[model samples]
Target: MINWKYCIIGAALVVVLGMLFRMMFEYGVLIGILIPGVIVGYLVNNGYKNGAKNGIITGIIGGFIQGILVYITIDLNLPPFPAVISYILVFALFTTATSAFLDAVGGIIGALIRDKI
Candidate 1:
């Protein structure tokens, strides 16, 4: 059986790392969304055998929400509609890709440590 608690813990850690990456790299537009998506993906993949779909959906939703918050947090002044739309697209794409990748990575890692876990 897989350990979901550990997966959650890993996801949490990844979130923090993502925040740090944003702050350090000064990522624009998408990384913030991508980070949360990746975290969700990591957790879902580790939690279940057929979790890829769930992970992708969860990551997309999580990333979108996180991206909205991050956008608000970063930009005090509201921009134009085009800018907002662009931001949304960039964020969605980043989250979708990053989360999918993280899901695969987490799955592999979980499998490797299954016995120890």
Candidate 2:
């Protein structure tokens, strides 16, 4: 069974982090929606029971989705449709893995804090 509360809070935190990153970076996937969603997913899945392994898996899955969405949506803000489509296949694998790891770290931190509080 999944813990909806943790998931919701973690996801919300991620969204807030994303917005903040967006504001700071102005653009780019890092501070965008990618990290936040991934972090939340990782946190939610790990719950307060199991530990890092679950978080890692959640992060990997969430990050993949986020990366793909970011890749697809980036073009919405720019021109040259082909340019956007062209790179889609390029970064998919690497970015997903990277985001997953990053989110996993965040999840660990969030879980620790959540347990304390």
Candidate 3:
């Protein structure tokens, strides 16, 4: 019962809005992730039975995509070979985890609100 459409939309929002905020303001990373996380949380809560799971999936997809984009744009230029791969993996993991946690929290909150209403 995973809703692919909402997941894709959430990912798209994360990428587009994440980039937009990154370019226009300070604390862009946080703000970028927050907006999309909240949106995804709300959307996921509409159909998903488990808010945490839905949020985690949405966050992973969106965060990983955003992480790749950021990685490509930033161009850390780490030493070639294994080092580069390691760096990418670490960065991707960090970004994905951070976003997932934040989005999960938002999703939980959204679910609570939905339940209350």
Candidate 4:
């Protein structure tokens, strides 16, 4: 079973840390993605039977939020039309997939460690 609470918490942390690193130190967004990935990994691995799925869920939430922020920050001066929607969709999909892959890897590693110890 998926735990929504942990996923939301993880996503919140990702956004907060991501923005902080992005604004404060000029660090890459991947660093922000990575921290929450580890966190979601740890959380999901605790009770869930499928770490990858949980991680994907967590990533989707965090990535969606992050992607929206990115979209808002970017000065895409395209005409307000269907094109804007397409752009947002594509951007959202890309971010979500990337984050999901990274988070899944982290989740698998976390699950392994949890099992071992």
Candidate 5:
């Protein structure tokens, strides 16, 4: 059975880490990916496949939320709701796509580590 709780946890972790890394190192993905991956992997004893699935979910949720926040913080003067929604979706889709693969890889590694430990 799949545990969505871990997915939500992973997403929250990624979102928080994304902010911290972006502020400190200017590179956000690394901090978000491996940490959440390992956490999900450790908490859930599923194999790498499942780990990857959860990690992808985490990336999608976290990335989209972060995207919305990013759009809000940006100086884009588009104040209308629909326009803002469109841009948010676009930003989210791009960020999710960019982060998903590495996030999945992190999941795989994390699962492997879990198995070893």
Candidate 6:
């Protein structure tokens, strides 16, 4: 069974940290990959599969929320609001799809390290 609690927790953390890193550094995506892993690190005890699930859910949810937040906070300078929204959504979907795998890999690696210790 999937652990929604950990997923939500990881999502919340990744969203916050991801935004901050995006503003402060050039390595946002690279660092963001680890946020989910760190947030779900405790679940390593549950196994790599569980860790991966939690991380992917976190990435999906967090990516969407971040997308919405970006839409609200930044002006795309597009003439049509709908166009801006659609572009934001498209980019969000792409970002989520790309990041999900990295997050799962990070989760699995975290779990392996935890398991070994």
- In terms of lDDT, the poorest run of 10 residues in model 3 is 40-49
Candidate with more favorable, higher lDDT: 2 or 3:
3
Per-residue lDDT of candidate 6, residues 1-117 (tens digit)? 567888787778767877788788887855865767655855746788887887787778877777667555666466577887688888778767655766777678777878888
lDDT of each: 0.50, 0.53, 0.73, 0.73, 0.75, 0.73
Q: 1 or 3, which is superior by TM-score?
A: 3
C-alpha root-mean-square deviation, each candidate: 5.7, 5.2, 2.5, 2.5, 2.0, 2.0
User: Deviation in angstroms for 17 in model 6?
Assistant: 0.5
Supply the TM-score for candidate 4. Answer: 0.79
Off by over 4 Å in 2: 1-24, 27-49, 75-86
- Look at candidate 6 and give me any clashing residue pairs: none
State the lDDT of candidate 3 residue by residue for 1-117, as single tens digits.
456776677668777887888899987876777666566556666633466666777779988888878876888565888877777778878888887887777667666666666
Against the true structure, whose lDDT is highest? 5
Pairs in clash, predicted candidate 3: none
State the TM-score for model 1: 0.47
The weakest ten consecutive residues by lDDT in model 4 span: 43-52
- Model 3 whole-model lDDT (C-alpha atoms): 0.73
Off by over 4 Å in 5: 76-82
The per-residue C-alpha lDDT of model 4 at residue 67 equals 76
**C-alpha lDDT of residue 89 in model 4:** 77
Report the C-alpha displacement of residue 60, candidate 2, in angstroms: 1.8
